[model samples]
Target: MTADPTTGISSFDPQRALALAADTFQNEAEALLAIRAGLDASFADVVRLMLSCRGRVVVMGMGKSGHVGRKIAATLASTGTPAMFVHPGEASHGDLGMVTLQDVVMAISNSGESDELNVIVPVLKRLNVPLVAMTGRAGSTLARHADHVLLCAVEREACPLNLAPTTSTTAQMAMGDALAVALLDARGFHEQDFARSHPGGALGRKLLMHVRDLMRSGDDLPRVAPDARFLQMLHEMSAKGLGFTAVVDAEDRVQGIFTDGDLRRLIERGTDLRAFHAGDVMHRQPRCVRDDVLAVEAAAVMEQHRVTSVLVVDAQGRLVGAINSNDLMRAKVI
Candidate 1:
């Protein structure tokens, strides 16, 4: 029973706090499991309704449900389902114009009777938009007016008083995720599609960025003719600072590659470095990728071959560019 030095308030019991947190986890996990078990065809019905909707899925809620609704809308939109969150209060004040006959309305309420949300139900119906309700109460006003109902009921909240939106909100969040997963699968959404929607995100950079988007080309690419002196190849490699140089023929077709590692191996074998030509010292059949290959694919090539740099070539097998691990790291694609 220690008193706080700052506020002179009694310090909380750590064991009691931990116990409460554990109970919250258990309660939320159980709620999600229950919802998973109780899911019926209504879930599919909602997915089908939204899939058929030509306009966006307009999500609405109040308080904590509103917060959950916003996240649901974001997940849906990023996962190939066009969606937006509309505040119920704002909807009554001309924002309702956003809802059209082609849109689908998803109203979220734990009790399924949020007055603000319920107020706009009639207007949504009048607009002839499909209404999908996510609620804990199947018989409540919001559910009753909905074209399809997604039951998010829970036995009790993790709050000691069973009043706070704890386990209930968890259930709602899980249900929303489930909906997003199902909808994405139904739409045949791919990683490229998700990347298109989130170009600034890490996954987008990895999936959408191609070798041509980041590779060094032209004068920036370190290259030398097969007959060039070893010193000239070293100078090109040093000038480019890519730790490697490609050995090409007069037609700019890649014949081999000389890297710092090859230099070290040659020196270790006591090879005559001064008398060597680019073709003589370079390693034949160097690992390379097409300019159009995904940067992540290039990373994979580097990983599989245990190399830090990869040569980029065109359809005619001509040297077009060079990409290294550093380039991928700079682009955050590795």
Candidate 2:
């Protein structure tokens, strides 16, 4: 147990350090399991009340719990439920007016005795708002006044000092996630609904944005008749800046595609470019997609085949549009 004089600290033992880490993880896992088990009839009641709320759910807490409350409110809002976070301290300074009688109040306090939160309890009750409490102590004032209680009780703090909120906060966060998922499932929230809530996110782009929105249509689409010469197709590809040109038959059906890759191969093989038509040099039955498909899905197809561009066709296999990696990049679907 002697300290190392050179380092001026106790000698570190790797085995002991690893053991402590394992114990901490085990304790947190057990605490979260306890919180999960606690989700019973009371949890159902909370969901029922929240679903029935006509106004937004006002989530209020203080200190570390407030940070967790903000995340919970965001999760609730993004998933079918309308919610917003209100600081308990701010609520006392006339911010309490934000909570309406039709709204539901979700209060978070590990001790359930946070003085700032206690100040607004009576006002919330006077407003006749439903109070849902998330805390460790059921007998605590906040829990006593709550219409429903979510028990986030834990065995002990993960902090070595036992003063910091660690395991308890983790339990609370997991419980909040469970609540959001339950509500989302109950409301039958779909990907399209989620896209509406998160239009700026990747999933939103995948679900809401179509290939037509990102494809180069009309004159911008690099296309030429099958009878066009190789040089003509190359010129079209260069002018459109798509690195490829669609070779179409008289019926406007996509007959083939000639890209910069084909040009390189032709040059390597010393083919007479002047005498070859687009039909001779182009790749027949090139990868094609529908304009109605998601731009994200188009990107996936391009990446899967290691190609830079794809031809967009209609149900009749007629060339209607074109897209490249640049198009996906511009649309932020990449």
Candidate 3:
């Protein structure tokens, strides 16, 4: 019988609904904390097994566990641990060859009784591969066959129906993150190493890119002789659009620099432009950096001095290149 959807308006209490949401969040938080408290030597064993492996870490699971396995594999791969996801059901259909004796297999299952995963256990054992099992039950068959068991047991499912996988998956995901971080720390993975692995990401650009890769070189650099007229320096600065011009000596060594700030000071002091050369109004011994410096370091220098541009010079103090805040901005290094 069809009934009005809004007929039970008064029966649906708003206060009760708010209390239910709060209780659900509090319960899930407690379950996660309980799972964290249970971590022991087995967790370290899993890290050691993965570290000792000469091949990739093969992750396997079924249903929702499979989804979490895929994410864990991706995180591990990006964080310096070579890992890949393999569905247990597909492993039986010739994907088992992907597993090698040198590889470590991490199988994920809540009850540790997933039929698909069970089917691959014998084959993995036959291959003599190391197995790291992530499951709720430490005494299950999957755990019994594994070399190391990572228990991700949650007190209860967050789902109101208590049938869907929710809190368990969250616990599993958190454990996976912990494993990846442990491996990352053990391997001494640095930002440069991470950048090498993720060259297309922003962090990679900041760590891997050098100033020479983004700085203005050759004709693009704005330079004028120390004895050059103020109008000539202005023309060079205007042409380069770096808001500054370098004043160099005959040896190509930077004697000083004229920036927009210098121009403002000149105007405020009412200096005669007609008699002035670049050296007469330039800032002497301006801040400079080497061409080989990282773009991230260049950004740091700019921020340190509160300047927008920096001159790139060689060990001999000769002007070689130049870079501005705009360059760093364009490179996404800022």
Candidate 4:
């Protein structure tokens, strides 16, 4: 049975339901492809203009385009492009004063004719500031007034009524992302640079946090000498609370490591704990990292080697500290 068109109450029509969802995706995809084709040397022009701006790249739009512009501005700012969004309506009222000859403006309008934006374009021109217009209408007033043009036309809206700004907005968003990424690459923005803009997030922790920042050092480290009894290593592991203990030589160079897994395996083998020493029951080449390594990289080492804990070392390969899954979790880099 066919589903109700008005309320969209389906009567279990699998083919129709799938087609409905697929059509929206297909339309949006086609719109994005059209934008990709529409991009030309003008894209390079805008990028060069933006790169030359000593001040911020100011973004402006109206309605749905405004929302997209704001996101675009934010993306640009975070990716090292130095950008901000100014509401076109507000610009006409007073915000137009924010525009300087040092700045570049990116204005978006599907129709290429927002009055609020139009009112401010003349002021920008008078200030000799470059304006790049993103619009579907090539012959639009906004396009005619702009110093450069970026076309964002769509074949049709994804909306069944062909009225809502669905496909057009998607195209705009994709274009903004593309532009931001292009600028990011041009500026040679690195992971550390990205982390600087997002210091409070997991990515920041991953990029900026070091192994020493989260490792158990000094007395906090679970350590036992190679000649130490298995019972002594167990006591050290428990006292340190890292579920494992490293076996080191007299010079404090790591010899091996004994973990909870080692204990379990030894117990399953019916070996007498009292009979074994640290050197006899420990993993000689345990997964280990340096104190100065990125904590995220340490976590990756642990994961790739399938270990719960890693011994932290120094330049001389001597045991200095230790870290485990718990430390990574505490640092939010897991």
Candidate 5:
């Protein structure tokens, strides 16, 4: 008996659809848990092999596994492992030339019998390239030929028909992530290395940038002698446009700071500004950070103290530069 697909077009069941979606999640989660529990020393062996590789890790897959393989390659590359994804179909047509004796190959296939992948296994072996197979069939030909095997077997697909690559592909991705993480830990890869690889984004800015990199230094730094008149300090602050100016001593050490906010406060109190000097009007012990401090940490100091700007000082407390919320925003470090 054939049930016409058109027959159910007018009887959509929202509850049934929701229930099926939840079932898919539960099924995939269980598969991941199973794989996690089944992990063994083979996982460590593969990590060691990859960690000691003299060249890149070439990843290969077909169909849905190919998509997952690309993501895995990207994660590995960003996390300090040199890796690239090659299509298995292309490998038979000379892309296999990209694989070298010095490199390692990781092939992903849920069935452990991808014709495109299996066809090239012999070529890889002939070239003396180490083959790591990520597959579900431990006894299958791909596994038997592999130097190492990452078993990703799932009881069944998340598809109600049990024919789609649903839970199986999820398991492959998780296994890839596990390998990449372990390899990174073995190599001692850290956040700064990640930031260096991802230099175009906000994460890179926050991790790789320091206050000295973004601060206004040399003549751009606004500083005035402590004996300078209040009007002279205001002119210095206005010219530099950092919302404040540092009051320094004869030795160029930071004595205090004066800001536009202080000016406003003085005006509101009707204080005569003509009689004031930088030393008299400046707020002593103003917020300051070292030039070597991370820009994100400087942003924290500003936020914690409710200030818009901070002085950048050297080891001797001499004003070397200045940074503010605007500087951090411009650099995308906050």
Candidate 6:
């Protein structure tokens, strides 16, 4: 073990650090559970007020609570609720203009006595905006002016010094998450709605991606007539580079599929490739999906059936497109 020059001892102890971390985690977990049990009808009141507000939810806080408030606002905004964070100190210095009578204000302070926040309470009150307080003390100055109060008081702090904002901040963060999620559920926000807010994210790619967006259509789709010779199916599969070709009927309806694996198995058996037709060697009842189906669903279908590719069929069960595992990989859905 390396010695610490500063402490004149071992640089670090893994067991000691892990044990302490576990203690901190347990303390924070207990704090969140306590807050959960303390939640009452007032939590619903906060949601109802936010829902009715015509303007955005303006979250205000000081110190560590401010960091949590910013995340809370982001979560709310992304989950269908329009929200933004305004530092309490900035609000006093003209950022208060961001808060309108149409908006709702949520002030957060562990002790609920932040001077910067108290300075603007009257202005918010005079503007006739609805006020909500997330604080540990119910009777704090900020809470008294608030139309609704969410108790975020923790029994103890996780900090060894018992003075740091560890457990209290954790409780505040958990409460904010709970409130935002409740609002999300009440609004019936679906994954698609969430995807729109996060269009550049992986979730958006998974939820909003459709088979039509990634499928190989027209000439890109490998297709051959059912009566085509087995050698001709191989030519189509090789030309399209999809490892498979759909055997279609006269009206473009899919009859079956011929893949590279089928050719390998046929060659292994010394089958007469020259005489065999595509219909005779193709796998009947190939898995097919609609163009509008989610790409994630297509991936699920592939995984479930252990196939590398699937045919995309139209409304009348006619083959219109094809997609392989490579397409999903490019789209980052798989």
Computed on alpha carbons, the lDDT of every model, listed in order, comes to 0.92, 0.90, 0.90, 0.90, 0.92, 0.92
Model 5 C-alpha lDDT per residue in residues 35-111, reported as the tens digit of each score = 99999999999999999999999999999999999999999999999999999998899888888889999999998
TM-score of each: 0.92, 0.86, 0.90, 0.82, 0.93, 0.88
Pairs of colliding residues, candidate 3: none
> What TM-score does prediction 5 earn?
0.93
Q: Model 2: clashing residue pairs?
A: none
Q: Report the Cα lDDT for candidate 4.
A: 0.90
lDDT of 3 by residue, 234-277 (tens): 99999988899998988889998999998998889987887899
Best by the TM-score measure: 5
lDDT of 4 by residue, 1-334 (tens): 6678988886787887689789999999988887897789999988888888899999999999999999999999999998999999998888888887789999999999899889888889888989999888899999999999989999889888899999998888988998898899999999999999998898899999999989889989888898898788889989988888989999999899888888999899998889889999899888889999999989899889888888999999999998889889988998
- What alpha-carbon RMSD in Å does predicted model 6 have with respect to the real structure? 3.0
Choose 3 or 6, whichever is better by lDDT.
6
Model 2, runs deviating above 4 Å: 1-16, 249-253, 264-271, 279-282, 303-306, 314-320, 329-334
- How do the residues 1-334 of candidate 2 rate in per-residue lDDT, one tens digit apiece? 3689998899888887888799889989988887776678999989988888999989998999999999999999999999999999988988888988889999999999999988888888888899999999999999998888898988789887788898888888888898899899999999999999999998898789998888889999899998897778888988998888999988889999998888998899987899988888889989999988989889999999999889999889899999889888877888
Task: For candidate 6, write residues 174-273 as lDDT tens digits.
Answer: 8888888999999999999999999778999999999999999999999999899877888889999989999999999999998889888988998778
**In angstroms, how far off is 102's CA in candidate 5?**
1.3
Which residue window of length 10 is worst by lDDT in model 2? 31-40
Pairs clashing within candidate 5: none
Distance from true location, Cα of 139 in model 3, Å: 3.0
C-alpha RMSD (angstroms) for model 2: 3.0
Kindly list the per-residue Cα lDDT of model 1 for residues 1-334, writing each as its tens digit: 6899999999989898899999999989988888899989989988888888898999999999999999999999999999999999998999998887788999999999899999988887887788999999999999899999999999999999999999999998999999999999999999999999999899999889999999999899999998899899999989999899999998999999999998999889998888989988889999999998899999999999999999999999999999989999999996
Quote model 4's TM-score.
0.82
